[model samples]
Target chain A: MAQKPLQFRLNGAEKAVFVEDGANLLDVLRRSVGDLTAKRGCAQGGCGACTVLIDGVPGLSCLTLAETVEGRSVATAGGLPGDGSHPLQEAFMAHFAAQCGFCTPGMLMAATALLESTPHPDRDQVVHALSGNICRCTGYEPIIAAVLEVAGEGGGGRS
Target chain B: MTIHRGRGFASINYPIGMNLGGDPSQALVHSSPDGKFAIALSSIDLGQGMKSVTRQIAAETLGVPVEDVYVDTADSDTGPHCMGSFASRGTHRVGNAVIVAAKEARAIMLEAAAEELEVNADDLETDGRGNIHLRGAPDRSITTGDACQAAQFRHGKTVAGRGIFLIPLSEVEPETGEMTPVSCYAHAALVADVMVDDETGEVTVEQVNSAYEVGRAINPRLVEQQLVGGAWMGLSHALYETTEPRYPDRSHGPVDFSQYTMPGPGDIARHDIAILERPAPDGPFGGKGPGEMCANPIMPAIANAVFNAVGVRVTALPITPEKVLRGLKANGGARPGPRR
Candidate 1:
């Protein structure tokens, strides 16, 4: 296989790596970039476990071509504020939104996009936004509640 | 083309831990020089909060703060032996082993503290806040860290303990052919409300109300997580999930999540759960395993709900729209049964 050069701003840091042609962004980020936070689950763009921020929009990294992200900004779950202070992370912990946690990074990214755009989405909106992500363990109740809690909507005001 | 609503109910009792020769799990507990305890086990968590629950059991048994305990479920080579995590036995079996190991380590810890304080081991008690004191003498106390340090350096003793839990297998009676398969059981009941469209024969679960009598809720939040998630999985199994839609043919098998069907976040219904605790006699902290039983009742409840909604007794794993329509057509029309 032929290799290609790709450069992207990863989590606000410039990253340059050589990738095989047609390699998806998920493989490049995990295998080359050493960012294992983005999980590889059902790498067919259906599970949404590899969802990442591509230029401030939530996109499936598993389906994205690495060359397309060249010079573009890519953000993963690791980019979330550390120290356990991010509102979504705090809300997730308080609400027990993550189990097994394979889907947490993508769920957080999707919820992050929703909050950034709507800021106070209703229950139906939250459900619609998170429909693509599949969590085998959480039943989607706590995940939705965590996102809604951050939006000051639900979660029993626990957040 | 009208949509009809109906309700159905189901109840079930599930056994905790399998009775295969002796389902055994072992645990090892040892204290570091700083008095922090580490539990080594081969049981896997698999996102079921196994590590967290065992840590709590060890801390409680040792009379120490939960933060002072760490559960290391490393590989089988480094950790002790386990019969694997299945049959919902992680809590009941592994928890008991952890309690036993922690108790032994606690006894050793108290012995070291007694030696340092020039008192009997029976007269010393842990404060659960990193301190051990002589009975009736609050001023005469030593920090757990100091005691552990002394045990390692001055006393030439290792504050460690090993534990294993097993239930002897029951032999079948040749005359009656009866044998005890499990030690304890967890019970659950569920009521499911669903809406069925007469035209397309689509069924949508609207709400679910359930009650679970787990032996005891070791961690109430973790138990709730299991209930909610397990019920969702049940709902999926009843209506959506199928590895091979064309079963015997196996031609159009699903290769990825897109072709595979499961309930999405939008498909989740409203769930109301009530947890009942009737502690088991031989359970750890009077707690039984609630991992696999939470999803058992939803399948039957949904099937009965479909029957009530359209009078079609679709006995298949997934009551898909085609099956419902075929049943409705075969029955000559929509014959709504009595609503539960």
Candidate 2:
């Protein structure tokens, strides 16, 4: 294990941060990287609270070693269209699905990724793709509706 | 949404089978006997909006505005073993206890109201707005405010309620698979039409139509939302979620959320949700449990739909691509069932 300087873009801005060896991107992003939207839920990648994007693809920051993603493009839930005002976010609020708000980030990222691959993803596709993220509230209806709305608009995965 | 009212009371019922976690003395919280406020916060919001449901239950029962009904679940000290928010039992069971407690507290409030109006408690009834009025004279009603004032100042009185009631749920029989305990029960049917690639076992859930029998929908809007959420879980669990390692390990069950997939936004189908309320005999506000049952049958419904479309039945938790391919290979490519 070795310490090194890691350079990457957070929320679309270039930044340099020091990374300790064997540190998951989650720890570095929150503590060293100074971005707290990537919350520490289960921390072992079991919970999707810490999900961030690597190269526009949804990846669990908790499992990605900080050094491995150095000099690469990294994004978080903050980078998503709305600062909590995106269509997805709006849908979440309207449907009351983001009850606890803990799992929303992970859910958003995963949904963002799904829309990337398929614009008007149907219900089965949405359900299959988001199966990785866990929510304890509002079940999944509203989330499904939001994604479908975005997909229908051909907004599949971007701001 | 058709609310099938039952005599006495109603419950939102379902057999509990979700895999929930508990960190020792956490998750499950309760109140004490000495406390004046008899309350229970939903242990498992289960994304069902139960925090608000519990508050409403207590408020309605106590004949007070929801605000006056203090449903506190601050910390471990203020509560007893509160099962995590997973099942759709929040309003039914916790609300039942709260209702009983609130009813007791309301009785106390009514007693004072009776003394003030110079009428017997039997001659008084609480208006839905929490005002106690004599049966003959609706205009001569005492607000809960006045009653409380009389109890505290004029009568120098005190009253409180406390209790915890866990839904008596029974497990499905190992041999027959017949579920018992039957605390609260809800049945739902979901129809999912999916698009699967012959190359990959991956599936795209197209449209979904769900029907549930919630004993009661205290909040009709919330029930629909929670059902949609549950449908997502059921769909995801049937198609993707697994507790086994990508490799294999008995010591540690699947690592957590990372290794599994739950239904996400893209995964949602065109939804047609219908709430059928068969009010249980004991649910709060004539409402039975509809939360988890919405998720329970989704997998089977989806699986059945997939079978109907492509002609295969992948029975494991998630009807994954690999399994779909296997089933497809076993047959031809697609079997016919029903389309969503």
Candidate 3:
């Protein structure tokens, strides 16, 4: 195992770390960077709990090799907002979008990308955007509603 | 060459907490120097909102604001004993224990306040904002912080309370097969609408409408989340979850998420939930835990729907395509007359 020097913009701040060969981005961020928000649900990428916004696009941190993210910008759930002031975070809290919160970081990152790009995505669009993420507790309705509410549609005002 | 649609319904009842040789949960409530409260318990939240709900119970019992109570669900070594947060017992079991502990701590606060005001303890009441006032005199009141200081310095007493909730074991008549294993039960009914592809034998759940009598909802939103999430888990179990490919043979099976299949966001159907509050007499704030019961009815509802659609009773756990095709071939592809 070889340690490689890696530099990236993490949560709006420049960070540098040394990673082992073949280590994924999640490992470097959690073990080296000390940000435990991006969870390691399934290292094989089946569960999207390790999703991160890489250059404003939702990318699976567990699937991404450390070397590939060199000099890239990464954003996690902790990086969303310090005070839970983001519209999405507020919507999630209001709508009860998170249950166990294990998958919240990835879900937030994925929803963040969708909102940044489309802003007002429909139900199907929201569903497709979050398809990669897996939330075992929320059942996807509240999460979708939170994203839709932040998008300004209120998700048909469903309870 | 034709697709069929069908509907089915199921109703089920599940016990809230089990009495396995005396199921018990404990809580410790103590007041802080700032008049705030801390409750230490061994029950893990597990994302079921235990911390929030238990904190509310403590605050309500102590006549304090919710923000003044801090719930610490530390490990068993440091906190009081809890039977763990399963079997939907976190709310019913832990909640009752918390109320008891909070009540004890509240008594001490009231006594201390009575001494300071030169009045009887019974004449003092809390405003739930950390203020203790006489029954008739609202202005003549002392903050809980003052009472706590008096209790520690003058009275030399620790303002702490301990509580435990337990159910006595029921003696069973083995000859008659009758016994009360649990004290209360939660009920639910669900209707599932589904579509079945005749050629491909693929099934799709279109909608799920359910009504749950959840004793009471401590937090309505958290209950809704549990119902929705549990329904999806039921869907996964009914359609796509299996660890063993062959019976008693683990030669070939899914070892990881990629190999294993569960419902993703795309598979979610329209869900309509009706929450009914039927209070239990012994429940803390009349709440029967809905943690495990949410997944009970969906499996049978989906199974019955597949049968109604194709006139084939596939009794398997997951009504997979291969099994449906085999059943169809065995029945000579005798499709019911277009479900007219």
Candidate 4:
């Protein structure tokens, strides 16, 4: 595969990178862009660890070709916190929402896409949106709570 | 090692004699003096809350918060050599060790408090933040950090908490192929309702109604999170989880990440999680393990739900569309079920 020069909007900053024709966005983001926030749990799209945003929509970067991301606005977990701060990220830490912190970035980004589109998702909707992301810990309660916090639910008020 | 061989004690039925929930498990908790803690856990947080629990135990022991304490939940190297993180040992053994270490530190602080306030050692209390004072006189108090500093300056760091947790060893001998219940185990029951695609075998878990006896809830939110994650993991194992072999399964399973099925954010339905706070005698806070509990029952529960919904029983996991179709065909090749 031949290397190609690709340009895209990352987080909110426009960036350019060169990668082989068949390289995945995951590799490009991790190696080329130096964004380690997007993890590599399963190279396949099955894990949701590599979930990202392609034009504000949730997507799995591991299975997506780098070529597909050209001229598109890309978002990683790192990108979600435009001001280096997001309520979802705060709720995650306040609620002990992260364990290894490896899955934290990925999980936050995935949920960001969901909450951004639907601000007040019901419990069922919350589960459906998070179905693709696997959190071996926290089951789904606190994560749901964190998302619910954004919608003015009982998240930070922990006993 | 009592393997009762009567009617119910036979291979499948032999829970007959000895004990139902005797010991906690193989690796429990062992504590030392200061606040050094270790846990030999049958349970793991796997990014859940074990680490926090460990820290909580250490800090709470002497009336401190999490930031003032540090605990190592899992150890691949020389742990305080703790066990693997699988069950819910964070509150069990690890918490107990913190109790022990904190108690030790508390004794010293109590004696000091008694001398300073002219009260009984027991009459004194270490506030939730490690500051020692008389029961009612919050005015007469001393910080644990100060105490430690004083102690370190004089006697050199006393009452360090250390623990070794061994779960009930259910070691199945490779030679005999037998399961030996090393310690008492943790159990959970879940009731799940799901919607399935009759044509695609695609199933959506709508709700999970479950109750677990994990001894205690050191951090209720964290436990709930574990349950949610565990439930999803269970769903994956039952329906979609796959390890694309070093190569591929002889069963013609797909090798592509997109093709290899696993639970993702899109596949889950809403959940109703209920945590049962039944304190296990063997558990730390009476907390039994819930790490793998939710996962094991998910697939089984889904299969049962499918049976209740229609009239098809698919023994195999995941109950994919193809399996449902085949099962439907096998059952008189008809759309099997009593569709209301």
**Highest lDDT among the candidates is held by which one?**
1
Q: Is candidate 1 or 4 superior in DockQ?
A: 1
As a whole number from 0 to 100, the lDDT of residue B292 in candidate 1 is: 87
lDDT of each: 0.90, 0.67, 0.87, 0.62
**Which scores better on lDDT, 3 or 4?**
3
Give candidate 3's whole-model lDDT. 0.87
The positional error of residue A65 in candidate 3, measured at the CA in angstroms, is 1.8
Using TM-score as the measure, name the better of candidate 2 and candidate 4. 4
Please give me the DockQ of candidate 4 compared with the native complex. 0.46
Q: Of 3 and 4, which scores higher on TM-score?
A: 3
lDDT of model 4, residue A25? 93
Question: Over the stretch B248-317, how does candidate 3's per-residue lDDT look in tens digits?
Answer: 4677777888767777888888889999999999999999889899988998998888778876787877
Question: Candidate 4's residue-wise lDDT over B221-257, tens digit each?
Answer: 6777677776777777666766533234556666655
Residues B144-183 of candidate 2: C-alpha lDDT, one tens digit per residue: 7778777877787765555465544456689998854545
Off by over 4 Å in 1: A153-159
Top candidate on TM-score is 1
How close to the true structure is residue A157 of candidate 2, measured as C-alpha lDDT? Answer: 51
Q: Which window of ten consecutive residues has the lowest lDDT sum in model 1 chain A?
A: A150-159
Q: Candidate 1 vs candidate 3: which has greater DockQ? A: 1
Ranking by lDDT: 1, 3, 2, 4
